[model samples]
Every structure is written in C-alpha cells, then in structure tokens.
Target: MTTPNESPKDKPSSKQMICENESSTTKKNDEGDNVGGGVESVDGQNMSIDDANETGIDDPKGQGSSSRKRGSTIDVAIQIGSGSGSGSNARKKREMEIPRGEPTCYVCSKNFTSWKAVFGHLKSHQRETPGALPPPTFTPTEGSPENNNDDETNPREQLAPTLLNLALETMQKMSEDSNMSVVHRPSSAFNSPFWTTNSGAPVWNNNSSLTVGARAFFTKPGGANFDRERIPERVVHARGASAKGFFEVTHDISHLTCADFLRGPGVQTPLIGNFDLVGNNFPVFFIRDGMKFPDMVHALKPSPKSHIQENWRILDFFSHHPESLHMFTFLFDDIGILQDYRHMDGSGVHTYTLINKTGKEHYVKFHWKPTCGVKNLLEDEAITVGGANHSHATQDLSDSIAAGNYPEWKLFIQVMDPADEDRFDFDPLDVTKTWPEDILPLQPVGQMVLSKNIDNFFAENEQLAFCPSIIVPANAPKCVYHNNHHEGFMNFMHRDEEVNYFSSRFDPARHAEKYPIPTAICSGKRDKCIIEKENNFKQPGERYRSFAPDRQERFVKRWIEALSDPRVTYEIRSIWVSYWSQTDKSLGQKLSSCLSVRPSY
Candidate 1:
C-alpha cells in the first residue's frame, strides 16, 4: 500500500492495472453463495474485484463519491478508501438472487434479493394507508397479514438507511461484481403480460367481473369503463357526411394554374395538392379579417349562460359588421335551408391567386356545382324533417352511396388578370363579393364523384385540407426557403441571412442565385389596415334585387324574426336596418316596416 506522502507518479505498480489470473477469479465464500463475484470492468480499472473488496481501500472523494475513471477502455478503479462500518456490512450482503423466504415489500409484498433495490422500490408505493387491494401477482398467492398489518419493525425500515447508503455508494462504483446497481430485474420482464395503467403498473385479474373469490369488485382497470361509456358528441361539425372519390380533369386548364397535380388529367391522388377554396353553400364569408374569426365564433355559438344559439346574439354581433350583409342575403333566401348535401352548390368565396408555369399570376375564385342540381326546404318542412333526424343529411348521403347511387359535382374556376384588377367595380380581393359569372365566366376544370362511402366513421378526420399554400414565418418548423415577399396574411420573413444554407462560418455569404419575382411589388412597414375599397353595399344590393318577389318576402320575414328577439336591443336593430338600407333601398324599407309591427318572441 502507498503511504500518504508517496506521489501517484512514484507508484508505477499501482498506476498500470493488469487483468486477473484464474486463481483470483470468482469463488463462493464460507456462506456457500457467490459472495464476491467476477465481473468485466465497465471502465477497466480493477480486474481482481473480490480481493479488493475483502481488504479495504482509500478514496479521494471521501465516501460514496468515487466513480471509475472513464477513458478509452473500460476499467474498474480500486476505490482506495477505509469505508464506514454500516456501508462495509451492506456491501458484504450484496446479492443477485432471491431464494424462497426473502425480504418482502411492506405494500405489495414483492420479494427482493438486494436490500438497496427494496429501498428504491418502496418509492413507487404510497406512504398513506391503502385499501384491501389485490396483489396483482400472476399466481393466486395470499399475502401474510403480519408482513403488512403487524406493529413489528419493517424489514425494509430497520435495514433501510444502510441499504440507502449502500445504494448511494454502489452507484459510486461501476463493477457488477460487487454492486447490484449494474443488475436489474423489472417486474414486467418476468411477470405475466397484460395491459397496464398510465403509470405502467400491471393488472393480472383483467376480466374485471370474474374474481378468485367474490372480493374483487372494481380492481384497477378491470371494470366497466363508465368514464368513456359513450364518446362525448363532437363539439363542431356534429352532423356531417363524408365520402371518398377522386377529382378527374374534364377539361385541360393547365395554362391557368402552376400545380402539376392539377396539370394531369387522370385518377392519380395529388397529396402536395396546390389549391383548395374552403366554402359553404354561400359564395361569401361574413367576416373580412381572419383575426375576427375567434370572436365571431364566440358570439355565434350557443350563449355561455343560456346554452342555446339565440338569433338576437347573432344579429347584435353581426350588425356591426356590414361586410356580413352579403351572407345574410343568402341565409334569408328560400335556398338557405339546404335539403341535402348532394344537391348543394358550393362556392369558394375568397379571392385566391393562380400562377401559370410561365410565372404569369391571375386572381381566381372556385365553384362546385352539383350535377344532381339544387334542392331546398321551406321553414315548415325543415323543422318537421330535421326534428325527426338531426343527422338526416349525413345518413341520407351514406344511404344513397350504399344503394349504388352516387353524387357528383362539377368544379369550375373564374380567372381574372392582376393587371385588370382595377377594371372591376367591386373589390376582387374582398371575400364578401363574388366575381360576375357573366363577364369572368365559369371555366370548367374537373368533376368530383362520390363512388364509395367512408369505411370507418370514427377514423382520423384527415379530410381534404384546402387553403392558401402560405403560412406565417413565426409558425415555421424550419427556415422558409422561398423569399419573394409576396402578398400573404402573415408575410413577415425577417431574416439576417441572404443565403440560408450555403455559408461559411467565419465569412458571411453574399453570393445568391437571383430569380425573377412577381411584378406585383410589396412596399410598406406592415400595420393594421382595412382593404382600401370595402364596397360592402353593391353585391348585397345586386343579389337582393335578383331574387324573386316571393323569395324577397321570405328574406324580409326572416330578418324581422331575427330582429324581434327580446334580447335584440334597439341600438342593434337600428344598426342592422341602416346596414340593410345601404344594401338595397326597397328591401331595407320592407325589413324596417315589418320589424316595427312584429311582436317580440
């Protein structure tokens, strides 16, 4: 042994370690069990492990802190320390096997070989008093009450601190020969396989009702799943039908759009699909700005207090938004209550940009005209049928496909030149206005047919996601590669790098391959601003005038019913009248005159 004054450099014999000979290998002690065993050094320091443990060693980091020196090869360092008496005693009793009648857990009564492991395993159990719980062991073995309920000292608590310090010191070394830290025997590794709880505790008697005796009532997850007995109804789109089919090109309109998916005229599924115009039966969205969507949803949904969708709330909120008048005109029409999903004409109300392969960009709008023609239900008819089955439209469409009768819709697009954007009287970018079909014309692109019903009703709602191909730079998963600085909702692409990828660490990259950007240049420090020309009056006026005399009366009647709600205020009523008057003079007067005489509901 080296003296306290002796330098490590002077002790060349202790510096270089050698692998042990056969005589120095593992052998059982007087106890007839493998006391000190042979284990491969994880860091390769001490090879003759048993001899080092029998005789004490000194440690530089005091006690329970000496770890093997990590290097190029695995070596077990001979922890040179005069360790504590309790720690040395715990080390002598370290084991890798649990013979019958071993130390059992106070809670679950699980047997353990290493005292350090039992000290660690108790942490997974609760300290408080527990119920008469099943042991959950695969074997129907009964737990002795003396082990749990007795006032006698726990085998774990009596030996816990020594085991705790042994566990702490055992981690200080890396030899499986002297430490049980390297050896692990998890319950799942040896126990019978079954579904586990959220925390991964196994349940043996999973046939919840069937028991060994009559005592197993609702053991863990082995009972009726009352919490999830019925799937809580979908909060949104609660009643809607979905179908599977393909979009086929009826006409080659490749000259108008840049997408290769829309370029081909066949049955191939286009995943990187470029364009989709999100729409409903109406050809206009109520709100102008996307930010107003959340507030609009809050107002239009069922009242937080009443839990019912009140028309007065819808009116009072939208009366402030004059742009919503065009949608109101559609909603008040006889065609407002759609009789069937198959017969409705869907329109993408928003103005979307379509660029040809040659880089010529054109403003466009989308339309889906059903081949089955249009259908509608009056107020009386809708109430009777809807009350019978709230999911009538969903069930009807599914039943139609199962009966071998399919529904089809023809896709059409109205294109306009960006240079000619000023030629239109109404704002082309305004979602509230629809392009005049007479002048712009519906260019037939393709047709979609629902040939089959969806296989599973509760599968993932991975429906066709149709939106503008751009997103905010802040929401980017990675750096945005493209940089034209075109017109997008959240178009801030504030970046320091001119070249995102190709760059040297020391020197900033200046070289870039210049590409032609669109002729429409964006120049402004971004700020909150409305569209320059919000001509909300013109479209609503034109649409109201186009409706038949009887249809116009129905529109007037619906507005009166909406305005007559007791919750509807006089200030909001006047605001809606002023809004409708700007839409059409004759129609506005009819609504104003009707509301003055109508009784409050």
Candidate 2:
C-alpha cells in the first residue's frame, strides 16, 4: 500500500541494514494476491514472500529492517524481488541485534566485547597438557580467599628432597636396626695418599724443586713436577658445569631397552650431569656426523698462532660444510643467546642404542626438558648480563642450589624400533638432526634434581666428567662396544708394557706375572656401529615452516644477513643456497633474492 518513493522513518538505521536491496526487490505470490513480496534470482530460483519473511529476509521486522536500527548487528541478510502483480508489493526487512556491554569469558572470566577476543583470552587460560601449571598470573588480592589459603600453606614444605636428607634417612634407619651394626668398608690402603712420581714413590719435598745449590749454583733442573699440576681439558665441551643428581625410572620401558635405569619405577641411578651451551641455547651443532667433530672444533678454536678467537676465520671454515645448515638455523635463532644456565634445555645431541634382553637394539635420543619451561634472553640481554657478570650462569646455578631452589629437568627419550627406523623421515642417529616431537613422541623417564650445591667447586664441579659412552644396567644398549673394546685392549697392552719396565723396587707386579689382557672379537652384527636409518632434513624444514608467517620472514632475513657477510665466499654461498633449497624452496628463494642474484648451484 506504500508508494515506492516514500521512505519509512520507523525503519532501522543504515548501520543495522542487513540487506541493501530489500526495498527494491518486492513481488506477489502464486495466489495472484500480493503477500508482502517474493525474491527471484537471475538464475530463476525464487522464494515466496511468506518464506522470506519467516527467514527474516523480506519481513520488515526481520534482519534486513532491524539491521538499520540504532543498535543492531547482522552478519547475513536476504531480499524478495518484486514480481508482476496487481500492484507492486513492498519489500520486507529485518536486522539482528548485537548485545551491548562486555561479555564475560567462560574460561578465564575475562571481559571481552567480541567472541574472537574472548576465544584468544581462553587460549592463555588453558594449562599445559602435561599437567604442569604455569606461574600464577596475579598476586592474591588483599585479604582474598587465595591470600588466606596461602597463609596456611608453608613455602618451605614444598622444597625438593636434598642429599643431606637422603643420607640422614639412610643413617637413621640403619641406626634403628641392631642387626645392621657390622659393615665392611673398602681397604684404606687403596685410598692411601702418597706423594709419588708417575710411578709409586714417596717424594718429600715437592714445593722446592731439585736445584744444584741453594745460593751459589742455582740451576733450573727438572720440569716434571710443574707438568703434573695441570691436566688436559676435554676435547669438546671444554667449558661446562657438572652437578650430581639421580635419574629415576618413570615408565616401564624394559621391553624396548635392556638398560638397568629403565627397568622399573622407583629405581634410581646416581648420575653426574654436565651442560655446555654448545655456543648457543638451541642444540643445532656445526656438523651432522661425529666424524666432523674434531674438524669443527679445530676450526672454531682460537688460531694456534695467536690464541685468539676470530669469527671471520671460523665462519670461513664452516662455510664449506653445507650440511651444517640445519644446525645453523637453530644456532642463529632467538634461543641462541641464553641469559643463564637455568633457562635453557639440554640435549644428548647424539643417537645411542637401547638394547633389550633379546639383544634387539633400538635407536634412541635423550632430551632434558626444564621444569621451568624453555626461555631464552634476547641478544641485548645476553650482552648486558655478560658485561655485568661473565660467570653469570655459573653463579646463578650455584646460588640457586645453595638457596634450596633446586633446578629440575625432566628426562625424555624418543625411541625408534629397529624395524621402523628405515621408514622415518629423518636419520635418527644423525647428531645434527632433531626428531620431530609430533611424530616420535617423547616418553617420560623420571627426573633429575640438583638439590645440593657442591662443597668444593674444584673437586666436584670442575673435575667431574661425563661421557656419552658410559652406560649402566643391562637394558641400555652399547652402540660403540666393538670400537670401545678394541681401544680398551690396545690401552691395556700399552699400560702393561709400561708397568713391566717402570715398576719401583717395592712393586708387587715385578715378582708376579702380568695381569690377564682382554681380547676383542668381531661378531659381524649388522646393527652394531651402523648409523640410524632415516632422513635428516624433514624436521629442520618443518621447524622453519612452523614459525608464524612474520617469524618466518625474520628468520629468512637473519639467515641472509649472516650469509651476506663480505667474508662469506661465493662458493660457500652457492653451497648454502643449495642446502637451504633442499630443506625448503621458498627459504632458498628468499635468501637468493636478498643476495640479488640467482645461486649458480
């Protein structure tokens, strides 16, 4: 009944309009009577006025009309087209209303105006899937229930068990039982301290070296005593910190490994752990193969002539090893510059064998996840911390232990069944590669807690040593048994020959036959000493792509900046490009773009 040119003042506002063409598309229905209007598509699909109105499409009180109200929001709308009729039917309209005021998030109770903001807030509220709670977000409000509850709970009650407690507990139980009075201790003669030559002897005056005459004929005589004061540093990991802890059995893994440590729950093995930054927080090393380890160290160490570190020279040396790309990506990431020892994660960095009682060997990698979670300092923070305290990490670790805030690490092992190793996307035994956590799930293996600070830093922390070669309990597999046996045999023979000629007059070995020497045999075992069967680049590629789009851009940019150094040669650049291309084509292409030239290789 309304004229086409007349605008309705009662209609909703323009902002609430769900459909703009609702007024222009009105029509009559099949009964030959005008019933509101009908919608007709160019393709000939049509909707009756009544159906459109019910759907809030052609109805005046529906989304299309309500959308123009003072306070309304509509995501969708529909319109009815005018059909030939006695008189053109008026278009119907409707609009949806958006609720006002802040909506409370169901998960965290945070207030948000939109669903998107609320959803994002909920993600932060979600705890880690492993059942560990993140640090509290806010301090308890004054006199609140949380504050009252905190007053009842003593902070000291939750401290991790200490070594002193363990020793005291053992002593107390032993003392309580009368039957445990007699105990045999190892012979004290073996532990006797005698100042002697490399061979056994009693040397009286070690402080003053043998000189010709005290005042007149003073002559520098022997260098033997001076040389004995120093010992060689380890070939790798020259800078490291060691602490005593225990590795406990968390899950039953006796089926996969014959190692004693994994035999059962409640079993604990005394362990000494050492951590080195490996030049960064992330575990990517310079080389994939153990064979390249010596060479890599040689290149990174100071120049033999100057005994000073030269970054340009080191970079030039590593530039030849194209396979080092995977590691370099990690080394250059934000995790590279860690603030202190407590914040970073530790890795075994090498694949080891885990054998079962049946002599079946499975490849495995070890990881130490910090309970505090993985955190790293930016480059600027690293510089500031380093400048203020060169030994900041060492001090932090020592102080934390002294204060009873023991550092904790959860041990996890990624196991690879021998039969399925070949089917994996990357080489399991490759030291330079990382197993994708999504594919090879991390199995819990108890935890290690450093509850006691060493009394003597030199004797315990400094002199302590760790070797990947050391394994105890039957379930642990020996990957290097053949090589170790050979080396041991040769070492024993060499030591025996020296002892036969060099024993002192008081030696018992001079009158007796030499100790029995061990023999080495090759069993021709297909699995022994063999590298793990898998590819290596797939995970590294996945890591690169897993970063947010913005992060990916930054990573690529950082790589280019490093590669663009004038010192990086053309040949090295080509090799690097080729290596990156193998990991990811887009990464390689972006890197090439930064260089302003296509890589020849």
Candidate 3:
C-alpha cells in the first residue's frame, strides 16, 4: 500500500499498516453509505454505517461486525416483512392494546413512539471517542490474532487499532472506585441477565425475532419509557446554585410575628426556611409594579426574533421606565457582574408586614449579608472569566463545599412603624426603593450556614419551589391577603379532601387566632396612573455621588457607550441625558460631552 515515492526504510510496521487499513476502511464504510454504497437497507431506504455503529455500541454482545451483521439482517427482515396480513393484524392488536406514548429524548428533545427507539437513540449520544476522533467502527482485521489471516497454534502480533481505541475509551470511563468489589446479581429489573421485553419476557436471541418455525414473526415493540427529566426553569433566577442548611433563630422576635417557623429563640423547624428568603444578588428589582414584571423579563431576555440578548434591547426597554434608574445604578456599577453566588448579598426586595402577639403590625424588609465579604468581577474580568467557564460560579460553590469551606449568611431585617411610613419621602412598600441603612438600621435576627451540597440537584434544587403567598398568618396582611383558590402550574402539594374550600364544616383546618394588621384604606376610581412619589432621581444621584471618582467615570463611560448606539433615537438619547442630569449635573454633562448630545433638562 506504499505511494510511488515510497522507500523500504519508510515502510510502516505491521501494527501501523493495520491501523491505516482499519481507519481507511471505517471512513469509507461511513462515507460510502452517503454515496449509496452501503450494504444494508431498511424499509426501502439505505441505512448508514453511522446507524450501525450506534446499534453496535449499544449491543450487549459488543461492537463486533459479526454481531452487527446479525442485528442488521434481523432489522431488514423485520422492516420488509412487517406489511404481511399477520403482521398487520399484530400491529392492529398492538394499537388496540397499547396506548401511544411519545417518549422524548432528553439530550436532543426528539420524540419516539417506543422505549426501544428512544433508548436506541440515546445510545448514539453516549458514544464517546477520544478528543475529536469519531467513534470507532470496530471491524476485525484479517491478520489480527483474534481472527488470524492464517490459522496457527502460536501467534506473535500487536493489537489492532480498533481494539486499542476501545481499550483507551474503557480506561477513560473508569471511576476512582474502580477497584471496589461488588456482588453481582440478576434480580428483578436489576440489570436483567437476558435481554427482555417491557413485560419481562426474556429475549431468547436479540439478533432475530421470535418465530414459529419461520412461518410468521411476532416481534413485540417495547413500551414507551416516558422520562420527565426536567422541570420548568425558573423565570428569573434560572441559573443559580442552592445549598442545604438550617436557619436557627438567634433573636426573640415573638413580639414581631407569631409564625411557627419564627416561634421563639432556640426553636427550629427542619425545612421551614427562614421565610423563603428569595432574593437576588442585586437589592432592587427592575420594575416596581407586579403588572410590569412580565414585560420587564421579556425585555431582559433574548430578542424574540433573533434569540440573542443585546445591551441595546435592555437599555431601550429600561429607558422607558426611569424608576429602573436606581436599580441600573447598581446593575452598571462596579459590582454589576458578581464573581459567584456565594460572594454576593441578597434581599427580599419587597416590603412585608409583621404582626406581634398583641396584634400591632410593623412593615419589615429582609436582607441576607454574606459572611464572606461581597466580591465582584469588573466588566473585563467578567467577560474573561465567564468566557473561560460559564459555570464558574456553580463549580466554585460545589468545589468549596467539597473542600469544607462552607459559606454562611447572616439574616437581618429593617422594621418601620405604620405612622413612620409617611416620615420617609419614598413609599415604604415600593419595591424600587431601598430603605436606607443610615435611616432604618438592620436588626440582627439569625444566621444560615450551607454546610452540605445537595445529593441530587434535580431532586432537591430543581423541584424545590417557594411563593410569597406561602407566608404565615402573622406575616400576612389582613385586608390584602385572601384565598382565590387559583392552582398554579407544577404545584407539587398533595391534598386528599373532598372540601377544597377554606372554612368548610367538614375540613378540620381552621384559621389561626387573629393578630393586629394594618387597616389599609383605599378610596379612588380605577384608573391607570404613575406613582405620585416617583422621585426616581434622588437615590440614583446619591448612589452616583457615593461611588469613587474612577468608578463614577466608568459608570459615565458605560452610559455614554449605551447612549451612543446608532439605533438609540435622538429623543431616547435626550431623555436619558435629561434623566442623568436630573440625578447629577456633572454626570449628565460628562455623558453629553462624550456623545455630543445636549441634555434636555
């Protein structure tokens, strides 16, 4: 097989020659199928070597060509002979007996009618080759000892390259506990010794169908194994890592709330987390009203048409909602991009009410301060780190827990009296506003320690859910809270009572003793209007002033870049500059200078 310029000195060894021949043969076998040179046919259509390779990999007998050839023959025969009268009758019987199920492939999201088909498809994804090399189509070499070209008692030769590739793949998949001994079993559904149908009838020979003396074939398609592998990803915090831990009460807040989870000091509940403290790395949210939540998310998400997230889209969307300015101050600030989940702080974001045993109500806001001081990645740093490993934060958290560097967070609350709500210029319940630390200090409540990593992320983290409506009676506002009995999607709760309504005579569930709550009074015609106290500029101006000189310049530069987008209209640019000028004159002037656009205000 040498070229015209070949020398005897450059002639490859027997092993090298075997490898070259096998590699070329495998490539030709795969490519030839596309060019209509394949040997097998299924249902009047040519079957590629790639399909054969998939079957051969999943074949329990191994990837030998003899095993594959037998399987292919059986498949071809089954496909061609399936249109007979008896086969038609059998299919009709199957259709009547078995309901159709669309089992979806988890990897590719492809749907199949039978378990056999889906499982067979999954085998293709499971095949792993070395680096960029394709999966080996193992065909036995003629001169190899296993199938020697010339039969002999004694053999002296190197192993075939196909076998070598298989050996390397097997070695790569071996776990660290490979040496551990195990007792083998052939128990029910425990790695059945023989191939079987879904109904437990052992398949005598997988290569051929069960036949009555070659008169008719009675091959039964396996039942569909429908796998609901994933739950709907969270709308907001879709990408996050959660760790298990207990929230221990450190302070006596019995006067604050009569929640069983918050009963008294030293009292604890196993899984009743400290008020489902659902929060984000950033304290403030993008929108204030619940009505705008969906729209805000739509804008923040990838474009509907292109499916790509662009800053221009986000900036344009938020440009309409000036109240989002304060939030963007933090979003575009020095700590805009967090390094990891563990290093960032969290907030409840919304104001809640707390009732004392005496029925006195107080407005409360919750916060979680990380024990590890807050850390963040700069814009350049975030791009580089995120580009390197998209799952860097998740990996960091898991690695830290495995290495025993457990992360901890301290719980704190800021309480305000009902009358004092008017004392502040901003609305206490407005989610867009942050209760200043200088005015209303954070009260120490308890601490949380995530010492253990979850065993199964899907079972624990993915299925886990929480809702603000799940609040205790004491934390719930009297006039605002009401039962609508609206069941949500993916509600995992189990209830088995005929009476689903509250206050039913048959139901034993009774309302807790009344506690004092705010007497919220509303007297207005239903109309769409903006909040009267939308003093959106002051806090943002304060935030801008609080930043260091260099940081402020960076912030201005970022705004300038966003405003300079050719897609951004002159009106939008003027509006943003005017808004910034309202916040800080110097900032507006700086941006105006960079973009060569005059501030409207």
- The prediction achieving the highest lDDT against the true structure is 3
Ranking by lDDT: 3, 1, 2
Please list the residue runs of candidate 2 whose C-alpha ends up more than 4 Å from where it truly belongs after superposition. Answer: 1-233, 273-284, 305-308, 468-537
Task: Give the Cα error of residue 196 in candidate 2, in Å.
Answer: 40
Task: Count clashing residue pairs per candidate.
Answer: 14, 38, 1
The 10-residue segment with the lowest total lDDT in model 1: 68-77
Q: What is the C-alpha lDDT profile of model 3 across 1-601, one tens digit per residue?
A: 3334555465433212111211222333321111111122212212211122311111222333322221211111111222112222221111111111124454465765433344445445545432223343434444444575442211111222322233233222221122211212224225567777667788654432233332122332321221121237666668777676677788888888977767877765444343566677777877765545555677788887899877778878887788898998998898998999889898989887788767788889989999998999998898999999999999999999889998888889999987788788887777788998888999988877777888877766765556655632222222333342436643334445466577766655667776666455544533334455778888899999999999998898888877777778887788788889999999988888888788765
Q: How accurate is candidate 2 locally (lDDT)?
A: 0.52
For TM-score, candidate 1 versus 2, the one ahead is 1
CA lDDT, every model vs. true structure: 0.58, 0.52, 0.59
Q: List model 1 lDDT by residue over 1-601, tens digit each.
A: 2324545454323222222221223443332222222332222223232333332121212342243221111112233221222123222333221111233454566766543245446534422422222232322123322344432211222222322333333333422234332333334333446766546686443322222232111222322232232245443344566676667887887787756657857744422233445787888888876545555666787988888999887887787678899888888888889998998999888777777777777888889999989999999999999999988898889898889888889989999987788897767877788888899999888888887777655541333223466322123323225443444634443556444443555445465654434565435533334556789888889999999898888888888888889988877887888788878888777877877632121
Candidate that scores best on TM-score = 3
TM-score of 1: 0.54
- Candidate 2 residue-wise lDDT, 280-308, digit = tens: 44555666544344456777778767887
What is the TM-score of each predicted model, taking all chains together?
Answer: 0.54, 0.50, 0.57
Q: How far is candidate 1 from the true structure (C-alpha RMSD, Å)?
A: 22.4
The CA root-mean-square deviation of candidate 3, after full C-alpha superposition on the true structure, stands at: 21.5
